[model samples]
Target: MAMDRLFAPPAERWQAVSPRLCSLRRALLTFWLGLLGLGGAIVAGVVGMWWLGAVIIVVAAAVYAFGWWLIGRNWRSWGYAERGDDLLVTHGVLFRTLVVVPYGRMQFVDVTAGPAERKFGIAKVQLHTATPATDAEIPGLTPDEAESLRDRLAALGEARAAGL
Candidate 1:
């Protein structure tokens, strides 16, 4: 099957959903904040007659740029998909990780919307499992979508628990 056609809606039972990631405004903010801090340190060091000011500024700028690049790359690679019996989360650029949470193992689901998420009309769905240490999460979902998913997951867990 063709790649585009593979992702065509309806025919594909599972679809990947990801947050919008960093907006242009957010990226600009990150860059400017980084630059500002670097500039401030440079000025302070120069005033203090520190010999390593130039090197520090250069290193800081490089680190900041690298961090921004990583964020953007990871953002593009991060997404979640809900299949028949499990929720799949795929993330990371350098170290790819895929987490599968089976419905039967789900303990509870939480649908939460923070200020930033509300501004973007997005919500986060956290799926708690019997696992003692880890909680599965699907961030950047629409409010209605998240609620619907939560309900469906809850019902599935309940049905599975009842041996349905």
Candidate 2:
């Protein structure tokens, strides 16, 4: 009956990821492409195609700008709620997806951070299950938060499995 409340995060539910994720994503993209742009410019200049090099740089900048636009929206799209029996993960902007992983179904939980993610002090939490199709992941949380979530999930998994 109340459609307005349907879209909202459930009461005391849905822990949001770090807002800095957008900047972290954009920075990672820029760092990777910026290096390529620099190399391309150098190579084109060596091959006597100064114009091509300039065009490459311009295109790189434009692409980065477009991708940066999506980073914010994509960052905002992620949410996770720990229900009594399962974890609900929702993400995506143009392509929405929802994953439900039962606590008893989780085989393990992994917390990871790549170079860029470590630099940004963010980590991703991956949930492993016997059924790969039921696995889920939650990204863009601080290292501490990620570890806490991992511990909680593992405990919940063990408790749920013991009951089963």
Candidate 3:
């Protein structure tokens, strides 16, 4: 599609995030929504409001259904690429974002994985620049991939910075 080209990778090779990210998101959504439904139902019962409980449960279920689908789409939307002098990260379905972090401007790179992300076998690579606006991150990468990217970016940043 015409819109796809607008956000395509510079080198025509966009590396997508792991699909396990989708699973992680869906699992979290299910847990939170389930808790909401259960907690609401219990509160409604204690207050003698069966109708309100039903409404809450129905709303939570609806949100969970929508969230489950949206999570997959969102995960699929994420991608990153290392170009000649910059790293490109793109994401979003309705409101697209493209972040270009130049090697020369990179201050440091951070690789992190929270418990849930680790459970899902995924990590995030965050690029810190001298300017906050240009800071970017690529999430849902495998640990090995995240480390490799961090090393490459750090080397590039050092090389470029030393030239200045």
lDDT of 2 at 46: 100
Better of 2 and 3 by TM-score: 3
Q: What is the lDDT of residue 83 in candidate 1?
A: 72
Candidate 1 lDDT, 29-107, residue by residue in tens: 5768677767777787869946667666667778677777776776666566667777676666667666778888888
| 146 Cα displacement, candidate 1 (Å) | 2.0
Instruction: Estimate the TM-score of every prediction.
Output: 0.69, 0.87, 0.95
Better by lDDT, candidate 3 or 1: 3
* TM-score-based ranking: 3, 2, 1
- The model with the greatest lDDT is 3
| Model 1 residue 137 CA deviation in Å | 1.0
Global lDDT scores for all candidate models: 0.70, 0.88, 0.92
Residue 147 alpha-carbon offset, candidate 1, angstroms: 2.2
Q: Which is the winner by TM-score between candidate 1 and candidate 2?
A: 2
- lDDT (0-100) at residue 139 of candidate 3? 89
